[model samples]
Target chain A: MSTLETAAQPEYLCRIAIDPLSRVEGHGKVTLFTDRDHHIRQARLHIVEFRGFEKFIQGRPYWEVPVVVQRLCGICPVSHNLAASKAVDQLVGAHEITPTAEKIRRLMHYGQTLQSHAVHFFHLASPDFLFEFDAEVARRNIGGVMADYPDVARQGVRLRKYGQEVIRVTAGKRVHGTGNVPGGVNKALTLQERNYLLADLDLMIQWGRNIVKLIKQAYALNPGYFSDFATIRSNYLSLVRADGALDLYHGGLRTKNDQGQILFDHLDYRRYAQVLREQVKPWSYMKFPFINSLGPDRGWYRVGPLARINNCDFIPTPLAEDERREFAALGEGQPVHLTLAYHWARMIELLHAAEAIHELLLDPDIFGDELVVRGEMAREGVGVIEAPRGTLFHHYRINEDGLIEKANLIVSTTNNNQAMNESIRQVAERYLDGKELTEPLLNQIEVAVRAYDPCLSCATHALGQMPLYVELVEAETGTVMDCLVRDADGTFRHSG
Target chain B: MSEEQSFTLDGRRVPFQAGQTIMAAALAAGVYIPHLCFNREFAPHGSCRVCLVGVNGRMQAACTTPAAAGQTVESETGEIREIRRGILQMLFVEGNHVCPACEKSGACQLQAVAYYVGMLAPHYTHFYPRRPVDASHPEAVIDFNRCILCELCVRASRDVDGKNVFAVQGRGIEAHLVVNTPSGKLGATDFSIHDKAAQVCPTGAILTKHRGYEIPIGQRLYDRKPISVVGDVATLSESKGGRRHD
Candidate 1:
């Protein structure tokens, strides 16, 4: 009977596509191919948009780069701004900025990281964790979370707002503030700004602790499922202080294996090209960056909050350090490979950011009048920082006229491109393989992608454009069986 | 002075001294005509045409058109405003006036004049011409991209600094500011940061190095008040001891 049934039907491959991924910063799509039995064959995360900020920034004056690069990501403009400013610092030959300048930039960065991580968790990722994966689409959103858990919703809003206030006081405006210049900062923290931030520092720190606890509880609700969902064993990369503590603003590059074995440590980011090579694929506009030693297949690694948490020996702050200890134990003294753990790790870092902000606020040097420093000029400079999502690199070369001759930027999301694809594949195989497709099942793939908090806009270097579409196709005849497009306006349409 | 010569400007009588242009007379009477290339300290170049107004039924640059007793000038009329807005828009598209990234954004006279004339956007296609930034100067940087060919720096260098450090070389769209030095670099020229040419640029063309965003955005020269109330950078520099311009 089985042989007769097999001979009666033709086995053909089918494809499922999720385009213009929602709840992410920019446009991305996922495509999965399966056989007649719905056994997953191939999975790909495609970055469709392209923005050549690196190309257009060429020929601009080097001094304007910090401000110009801020156009890369509105959510993390301060990260780009500070990274470019650090590169420009080398151009101006001020390899070491004044203590006050360093502290001021650190304060700004902490504020940015705090706000960005807050936004990603509370606004984008919380809906998935707070509700069942199979919950109705409308009920598995931020609006649903707000309606059901008003206290959680209110805390998230206040947390993000507090972080923005920190940025406004340190940077100037909460968005594209001109806080950092070539050699140093543009402005010092005023007494009024300092006092205003200080008034809320304790409350923000407490809120940060509360949010971390909230994510912990969310993870505990389904530890077995959460720990294994889209889990993959891969290398992690981030920046760590000279003493092996996590330092978001300034640090040397560090990479570790899945088993928590250090691959490289204390490597100067200026030598990044020596160890890293970006491989381009025809399918996606985003480049796949991998460790040169490992090559593309095994060289590709994870970044951002999870990677930072995994790669660092310890977070310096007391509250975050304790949380880190608990989080690390999840792997039994090894790196946590759970993708959903990104939220837990992100909350820990958010607490660290709040603590860092508190420390910097008390430092008297932040208000010093000596804001800028200068020296002989250099022709080339490279800057790297641990941005909210992951590591960010800004490299530039200038001509004799002080015009930018060339620029290369490897943003955080770009670094995790391969990891994101791998995570999507893992989830697609586990949840989508051999199963009837549904809206909830499709969201599983997105849940994995969102674990990285991927900023497709930042990765693609594109402006405001994000739309997702999904398509199912038959491989034998190359016919699309079903199609779903989520327009840029957030409206969805289903058609064949 | 003898009986002051006066002109009826936008229905207001503006008194003028002998040999003063309508723009100078109107400015002296606390009235703003939304100009770019005209400065009180220099001979009216009348090149930008931003201050164009109807004079007795004919359009003329207020800076070059001499004021006369009982002469009627129309500056605040809808037709005159539209013309001014067009001129401002043209000036914007002609150069790379990225105000958000410009150091002189709030203090820039061209931006102020554009705002005073209600220019909401650059209405024409932008001519994103490649321009060089002369940053070799230790104290000053000249971004040629922001230059509108107003010749204020050229005139200021020649008339006030007594050094012919800058000049406009090309004609029409090809016209651009060039340093008088053989190297064609601002650093190679005998131009000091203190030179009047350094402070006379209507845009971010000529800016002092290491002083960008010094005063922050909200507290800059034009941020606190409209150009109509505070006048241009030159007037503020002259009256307020250059405190506001920088």
Candidate 2:
């Protein structure tokens, strides 16, 4: 989006809207500002679009939402898809899906986390560690990382590729493939696909070793590179399974305040709004989220890396345990409040996920019989699976005629609205140095902002918003400079 | 409540759960609804109106309308009656519903539905769109011209399917199923009929080649009788209050 002209000294405002950020699954944007003191005054995330999938599907059939929304994020489709599918299964009162099928889906969910994390570490954030943060602007890139440590880059690429490959064989196509369904999968995998997946599983072993080495090296060489010029922290949150296992794709909400104390854990999904509430600010369209009890300013619990690491009890995979310990060491153990520690946390999850995927392949019925449980058409249901970004819930109210009358969707990214805003504000306040304002600083802010891997598209959604209004305010006078209801992507239009 | 006005199939009474449609009760009882567009998650959109049946004295579309109390629905009516005949004819005339030569013939729900309604001719003039066939997925195929705008495929895509891959474009009779992506193809977008939403299609509009005939015609759905009879044989735990039995 183009910046509006301000008569008063243009307090450098960078509005970065990246639709379908390359190497990432969904669309989102980052905004930061430098005040008169040149000190960063404000940073906001504008999620203008909304699939309104939640409202759009008020009465839509239950099973379809998972598949439909799974594609919403090409990167982490299965998690949201399964979460929604599971929620739908609960809604209609259908029998639980086969243990094997559910296990396969869980395995797939881990694959999603693995692939998404590798993408962030290798392609998204590697440039900073490879070329020191203080290094020349142009020198920072995948090329820079490869120039010094080719093996790290290669391993990262291979690990991510293995994750995508796992999705391909079990689900069919690599990105948002078929095979997952409410009752069960459409078709069981063939022996060939199964064997191929197991063989491919070995690649992550070598790749995971490289991941540890790289993270350790980055910490040792330039610990400050991972340091927070943007000193900030927020309450962390995540989901856990019934057995108290770390639930990536299936779990209720759990949260911890910045003080490193568990605030809430194992809250039922139906009452998610009771704990997490939306807070939309006038400056930006993106809705800020907070613990409902505390309200807006007081509630700022973060989801994703910070949340998952703080909330999860034990890392299922052994390799990931050491990485987690190393991360805890950064912020002095217990509940690490340092936001940059998200990088380390994300890596540990990736390492753990790779192992989970391997374990899933070993299940005898991974491609065995019982793909679907045949059913009558009149059943109503809700599916609640976790998207890579956050918790995704799909609720369907099917009419006797079996038509969709209403649909309610609560996606994962939206689950972190409040924490996202607070994180942005803290980062902006800390990093926006007054004197020398360069674009690289702004870009790094965007990248660091993305370290959380926000899914604004999934959060803002689509088709749900008919007309999105963009109101520009003059920072000096604090007056409404101009209010235009721009079409969702920030293209100002006279008409809706 | 004493006699219960009970109905049983093979000594087992369907629960006939309240709010539960005959289809759901039947499926719960292991009975199947021969529907193409009806998926579990999405709200039913009964545009194709193929799932028409007689409830009590009136006729209604199974997917859109409700299954009320003390209702008896006929899946197969003698002579393929006006509503079923009209639905079949319109379905035939709407798309390139050319059977026999088409791969989905024999196993197709349109053909099966047409057979159930005893449809022999396309009474209305054919207004076929010279639409291209989209066989994009290395596995799946999409032939627009041969499609019967049943919207089950469309509904499946949006509601149950989730991807919203298929959409109804062009108004009125001019409407045809268009792929939501740039290429206007299923493969281009994330779609595979392998799922219930995609595979639930009834007509030749969305067919899976190998799975068919593989089950044999005599044993195939609707061939033994209508879905109502097959559906009736499966319902269990008959509801004491008025419930739907197709």
Candidate 3:
């Protein structure tokens, strides 16, 4: 792996970079600048890849957008598929889909949320929480979790596989399934497919409860540190049902300030442009989105499990709601700003997804025959959903010929851009400020970023690339003092 | 009539009728020859040379080359398969054929033929040519980027539909399929979704509107069986009385 030029400014006497962040969905770099006394001055997370899916998807037929946009990210393609499908439904003038179609889509979304959060908590983020943050790199991964905690590791794999099976039965494949169409879905759940998913429903729910308990126990081991680690105060945004229930598939927009005060509720998502605006910076490829009323600096907020859990009134499911009550008490009736609490909140959603899947499986609507509905055509449409990562938006304008003239997508990871940077800066200040650069210190920065479970590929719209590099350099002579590279295969080594 | 005409293909004797191409004779005798852009319903176009085989020490397109008495045609040979793979690769790079997101992924003739011939990857830099998509038609959409100059639709519209609604324009790399309409859009023409032209495309270029991925990937035509086993979609549609299972 070749090292690029250090992105250090001349104002700082030293620079440290964590390039090609490991265990994240896509490629990104974190650069920290320090003064002569090794006091870290500034930290920035840089998205180095560029993907222009919005531009390329401009001329495609409106109906193809749901399937074609799945190319954005392999991890959360179902989210993109459903989001684009919802937008296409509006383009076809089907403001509301049929009952069967709605149920099928909800099942697919919950399956996606279940699988995605399972992978993040069990496979990606568990290694850090189960092991010491400064543990050796070799033993700080899923393999190590398997070696030490076999049951936890086995359940994680099974839970993830079960979620994938749910996707397969509903959408037709584990990845890039083609179940959703413009106005509705193309197929309904069959008896065999339903039975296949039902056989594992109870076990998945049981495992879901077990994993949630696992994360809570892990958090309890070091409450003070885990609660304070990478913690920050920022606004939260998500979607909630009209009755103030947490709705992952569809709902009106909601946002809350750092103090848990509602900034907006039941706001029509179609008018999102009236409230949200994106800011582009030269340093990073990911766009910074902020509330239109608050401006860039303070308006920038957090999205994903923590934000969704904090912004919503209650999770509709019984078990997750009980967990939510306990989690809410941690904040003392305010929003929980702890970054590591994200994993705990994420587990709650996983259980909710399991319970939701159980409920949908028992409902006969999923097996109904009326799967599609259509109406008069429209020129413009917008779709918004609470993806596993956070709020995802897909908007499009089509010509009279039904060809897409323009497209704009604000993915879940893009919604967390500024908040991720802030968390990284906070971690850098607390862990590495006025200290010698070490591998453990660098891992702390990554731990903070991974708390958000950022899919950099989705944020940058890139594909087939994730290589991270970390470099510590002397700013005076522009000489590299230390360098570390993490290849795409998740192997790391020291280099010049 | 005396002894039937025959040819030796890959060491197997293939019986043929009078005035039949090598490809026709092979398919008639239940033998598989990898091909694209050649259909049994229409006269052999022989444009996509994926059916190249060694005929008496000469490389020839099986769809256009005639079968003769005792002629030896060597197919499935390593060298011939390599050339076929190269031709398939060029066809892939020449057009923006993104199979993953394509609506006709599993059932597309081009994709099936590529798989049959073991064309693993594009094996060449993609041209990524910018092309236009005409979705004006009420029943169909035409994505010109995926057109491989196969001329199947051009022939189907002109001969079967008798409308002459489709034609090929330009030359060489610039050659493209066009709707023969005053507005140059499929909606402006008298083309119907039932036209043979709509079902004859070997790629995702010409697709029926609002009906994509109706058959799941694993259950689609080529997904269940190889193109060599199930035959091309056009011939299968014809055999099924003009109704496509895909």
DockQ of each: 0.46, 0.03, 0.52
Candidate with best DockQ = 3
Candidate 3 per-residue lDDT, tens place, A1-496, comes to: 0011133464555777777677788788888878878877778888877788899888888888889898788778899999999998998889999999999999999998999898888788888888897776666788888899999889888988988988887888898998898788878998888998989889989998998888889878898898888898999999999899999999999999999999998999999999999998877788999999999878998999999899888999999999999999999989999999999999999999999999999899998988778899999999999999999999999998888899999999899998888888788778888888777788898899999999888633222224667787877778888777766554668897
Candidate 3's residue-wise lDDT over B12-40, tens digit each?
99999889999999998999999878888
Fnat per model, in the order shown: 0.32, 0.00, 0.39
TM-score of chain B as predicted in candidate 3: 0.94
Error of 1 at A36 (Å): 3.4
State residue A75's C-alpha deviation in candidate 1, in Å: 0.3
Give the lDDT of residue A190 in candidate 1.
81
- Model 2, A349-454: lDDT tens per residue? 7777877877777777776666555344434455555555655666566554333567656566666665555555655555654644444444455555566666
Model 2 lDDT per residue over B146-243, tens place: 66666766665666557777788999777777888886767677776554445555554554321222222233344455544533211212211112
Model 3: which docking level applies? medium
Regions more than 4 Å wrong, model 1: A1-13, A459-468, A475-478, A485-493, B134-140, B161-165, B178-194, B209-211, B235-246
Better of 1 and 3 by lDDT: 3
